[model samples]
Target: MRIIISPAKKMRVDTDTLAWHDLPCMIDRAEVLYDKLASMSYDELKRLWKCNDAIAALNVERLHNSDLRIRLTPAILSYEGIQYQYMAPGVFTDEQLIYVQEHLRILSGLYGVVRPFDGVTPYRLEMQAKLPIEGAKDLYGFWGSAIADQLYQETDCIINLASKEYSVCVSRHQKPGTRFITCVFGEEKDGKVVEKGTLCKMARGEMVRYLAEANAKSPEAMKDFACLNYVFSPAHSDESTYVFLQKKSQDSEE
Candidate 1:
């Protein structure tokens, strides 16, 4: 089994972390996109990133100076989003880290798909970015089946923890034999499963940690995940979707 999660926009370049690995498998492909991004003017970049003055300037600078092959941080240590914060991969034991390396995959606009230990640099591309490259209409078109092909090379069962944007790239191109299961984290509100943004992110992160610690080998193992008061609801789940819900009050306090 393998798990796929979304890459975060909030990133940091930390040299303090000793764990590092070679560049992502699609580094060459990333360089091609980098070149396209680099050719755009600052104003164009601002438009591409859809950011404020500060963020746009920072990313423009990053695009100007960043090298895919040079300065790098482990993908696990780089992302600082709410999901990554909850996962707290830095606190994981060596065995858990190994499990993550073998089982987790990060969906990225820049790198396509990243392993936990893959070396990465700071960038500001989202999967939904509108940058039309070569003959392709957008990032999704440029990626096509490459991401799914890579995941299929790794494992047949994919536990998708990524958001819809990144997840579509995989779901659309899944191999015939692939088993894709999506875990839904939410609260049962008025008898309906309601997914709030922050709670869902927290649950997704905690679920990753749970999987790593338990060395989960199948989707059925995920039903045992009880982090942050989330409990599996079989009645709300189907064959391809697993629903884990917390109480409304329990989510509000967090």
Candidate 2:
């Protein structure tokens, strides 16, 4: 099974902790995107990035000076979002790290898809950003079915730990007979599963850690995941989605 997750917006360069095993598979495509972004003026790029002057300037500088091939951090270590922070790959055992390297795939706006150990540089493009490239209207159109196609080449089953923005790129273009299971971490409120953004990110990250440590190999294996107070709710889950509800604490229940 392949675990698909989203890339973090916040990133850093950490070349000392772990050596990247290889460059991203889509480096050529990333270079194409890099060239496109490089060609845009500061004002255009700032608008495209939808950030404040400070963030835009930082990213513009990153684009200008960064090389995709050099001084790269492992894709797993580069991201600094809550999800990655909670996953905490830096503390993982060697075997756990190997499990993740084999199973995890990160979806990116600039790079299409990357493995855990794939070398990557920091960049600011998001999948939903409106950058029309080579006649494609947006990143989704630009990526088309390529991402899903590559995932299929690896396995027939996919465990989606990514948010909708990145997961949609895979879900929308799934091939025939693929078992795409989405794990939903939320709470039952007013007869509905309500997903809190920050909590969900934490759960998603923890879930990846759980899977890696367990060396999970099947969809049924995922139902056993019980990290960060999330318990699988079979009543709410269906064939395509596995729902996990956060159990109320003793203090909260009082």
Candidate 3:
């Protein structure tokens, strides 16, 4: 089984510290996107990135100066989001790292799908970015079935931990006989499921860590995940969706 997750916008380049691995499988395709962004004027890029001056300037410099093939960090270590911060791949053991390398994939706007150990240079492009390619209206259109095809090649089953923006690419193009499962993390509140953004991120990260540590290799194995006070809610889950619910503080008190 493979677990898919979204790439984080908050990133850094740290080639000096980490050992570089092979470039992403679709690096040639990524080069096209990179060139398109590199060719845009500062104001146009700022608009495309939907960021302020500081971020725009830093990314522009990175695009102009960085060599994608020369220096890179592991894709798993590249992101610095709330989820990644909590998952903390940096501290994983060798066996855990191997398990993650084999089973975890990050869905990227720039790189399509990346393995945890894939070498990547930092740049900004979201899966939902509106930048139009020649024949495609948006990044999703350009990516099309390419990412899904790659995932299908890797594993027969996919445990989706990514947000919709990134997961859509895979969910839309599954070949017949493929198993796709989505994991939902939320809390019970007022007799409803409440998915707070930050807690969800933390739970997703923790869940990934749990799976890696346990070397979970099947859908049934993942059901055993009970990280950060979450418990698998069988009544709330189905074949396609697995829901893990945290008890509300008031409920915990009671």
Clashing pairs in 3: none
**How accurate locally, in lDDT, is each candidate?**
0.91, 0.94, 0.89
Candidates in descending TM-score order: 2, 1, 3
Candidate 2 lDDT over 1-254, as tens digits, reads 99999999999999999999999888899899999999999999999999999999999999999999998999999999999999999999999999999999999999998999999999999999999999999999989998999899999999999999999999998889989999999999999999999999999999998888888888788889888899999999999999999999999989
Clashing pairs in 1: none
Question: Candidate 2, overall lDDT?
Answer: 0.94
Q: How would you encode candidate 1's per-residue C-alpha lDDT over 1-254 as one tens digit per residue?
A: 99999989999998677557878999999999999999999898888888999999888888888789877899999999999999999899999999999999999999999999999999999999999997998999999999999999988899999999999998998888679999999887788888988888899999999999898889899998888888999999987899998844645768
Question: What value does the lDDT take at residue 59 in candidate 1?
Answer: 87
For candidate 3, the 10 contiguous residues with the lowest summed lDDT are 13-22
Off by over 4 Å in 2: none
* TM-scores of all predicted structures: 0.96, 0.98, 0.96
Q: Which portions of model 1 miss their true places by more than 4 Å?
A: 248-254
lDDT of 3 by residue, 65-90 (tens): 98778778889889999889878898
TM-score of 1: 0.96
Model 2 residue 130 lDDT score: 99
The order by descending lDDT is 2, 1, 3
